[model samples]
Target: MNNSLKTIAFISGIVILAYGVYTLFKPETQISIGDVDLIETQDNTNSYITIAVGIVIVALSSIIGKK
Candidate 1:
């Protein structure tokens, strides 16, 4: 049971990491309203920072699971 749980946790961690990476590279689009063009800015640095935090959480979970 413990081993299976660990495996599941590890897989989830990998998925989160992948999702974070994808978010970092995903393109942001914007629409124009009337005479104004609305631009949606995607800050890659901020996205990467969020991903780093997620990775840290996953790492912590993995560590706790080992116990």
Candidate 2:
């Protein structure tokens, strides 16, 4: 049903949004040696895109079946 689809979309959007936010703050890679530590910084481009997509999905779900 349309309602079920909307519910699924809403949940998926929240999940995606959470994932995007998590990745945005999460470190990409890390390495540790005897006296040296290295960390790779994350590129926010993907996270931003994911967040945008999630927002769009959530918005669409809210408008589904509306006149």
Candidate 3:
């Protein structure tokens, strides 16, 4: 049971990490804040940072399990 739970958790972490990577590569839709147009460009630096954080999270979860 514990192993199954761990596997599920690991898979979930990987999915989340993949999503973050996709968001990093994918172009963000433009948004308008009042009269100013806010465009989100693909920021590799930020993306990598996010990915790193996600990895850390996954690593911690794998070590500690869930909470």
Candidate 4:
């Protein structure tokens, strides 16, 4: 049970980290109309939240695995 939990934590961390990176790195969508440029960007809050969650999960997994 302990090992399984650790594995889950590690996997979840990696997935979340990837999502965070994608969210942070994705380019804004831009639309140009008659010399007007409109750009839509991702919310910075969600990326930070995922990054924090990912780090926490990875840390917990390592601590658990060491036991």
lDDT of each: 0.76, 0.92, 0.76, 0.90
lDDT of 2 by residue, 1-67 (tens): 9999999999999999999999898866989998899987778999999999999999999999688
Per-candidate TM-score against the hidden true structure: 0.59, 0.82, 0.52, 0.86
Positional deviation of residue 60's Cα in model 2 after best superposition, in angstroms: 0.3
Candidate 1, 1-67: lDDT as tens digits: 8767767766777777788899888878889889999889887886677678668757866786554
TM-score order, best first, reads 4, 2, 1, 3
Off by over 4 Å in 1: 30-38, 43-50, 61-67
Q: What is candidate 4's lDDT per residue for 1-67, written digit by digit as tens? A: 9899999989999999889989998888899999999988667899999999999999989999674
Query: Among these predicted structures, which one has the highest TM-score?
Result: 4
Better of 1 and 4 by TM-score: 4
The window of 10 residues in a row where model 3 has the poorest summed lDDT is 58-67
Stronger candidate by lDDT (1 vs 2)? 2
Cα lDDT for residue 11, candidate 4 = 98
- Model 3's number of clashes is 0
Q: What is residue 32's positional error in candidate 3, in angstroms? A: 17
Q: Could you list the CA RMSD of all candidates, in the order they appear? A: 3.7, 1.6, 6.3, 1.4
